[model samples]
Target: MTNTMWMRGVEWLAASAADPRACKWEWDHGEGIALLEAGRFWDVLSVPERLGLLTLDLLWRPALPVPGPTLVDLAAGRVGFFLPPDPDGGWVGAGLRYATRGSWVAVPPPYRPARSLEWLVPPDGTGTLHSPGTLEDALRQANGTLAVLAAPPRGPRES
Candidate 1:
């Protein structure tokens, strides 16, 4: 995704922070996903100390060596975590780089947008953001990518 797309997500996050209805969360494993309930995101997600750290790092980390960004589905009540793209990317929950890739890192809590100082143009401008419409769509895309990641390396086949 381009900076503009990331910025749009950031804008949404900022707007959602104050809106009580705008509740979305992510945690370490399937158990965490199972434990979540509507209107209970803050309480459920904040319970585990480790998960709290992980969430903070994922959302705020500078460069997520991963090919794609971690996804949060507020409307669907799902959070999909992508393991870093490579080993040197850092441990999933141990430590994360919080300032490498983009401008999304500086977003502060309770997750409000930073006020604009001026209009800054990104190197790549005005491109369509590759966002999936629903939770199912996001899951499908994520799973497909995960499969490729999990596959054993192979040499190219002869034509």
Candidate 2:
């Protein structure tokens, strides 16, 4: 992405904060990341890194549209997917974490490299986010796939 586009993306992300100017200042000063509140413009669904990677692959199938911004914290072994806020808070899944309302998420500037935490898919400055239903489906499918892969091999039955 060009510098202008990258700046735009950063602006879009910082807009989630109470003070967008502060967020921009932090990035400009090399803080590397800014904490943005969740629930006003969007929420976050975080999952284990292994499962998240699989789900991301599934979401990126040739016929599917690209997913929204995602954050991966390698040291934390977690991945966070940005989603539209669900006032009803109806999302549920094993090992899934929903951050909304008063939650805060550490977000790195678009296209910038950060230690341990970084964006797997940076926002395109369009305010787009993943559909909760679609993300839930992908997560379920990815979880099932992991389970099957981890299952013990079946031996031949005795006669």
Q: Pick the candidate with the highest lDDT.
A: 2
lDDT of 1 by residue, 1-159 (tens): 455665554443333234422322321211122111212111111112233223434333353321222334333333333221232322223222222222122222122212321111111222211122232243345445555777999999999
Q: Go through the candidates in order and give the clash count of each.
A: 7, 0
Worst 10 residues of 2 by lDDT: 1-10
Structure candidate 2, residue pairs in collision? none
Instruction: Output the lDDT of residue 141, model 2.
Output: 98
lDDT (C-alpha, whole model) for all candidates: 0.29, 0.87
What lDDT does model 1 reach?
Answer: 0.29
lDDT, model 2: 0.87
TM per prediction: 0.21, 0.94
lDDT of 2 by residue, 1-159 (tens): 677767778879988888998888887786778888999999999999999999998898777688988899898899999999988777777778889999998888887757788888888888888877788889999999999999999999999
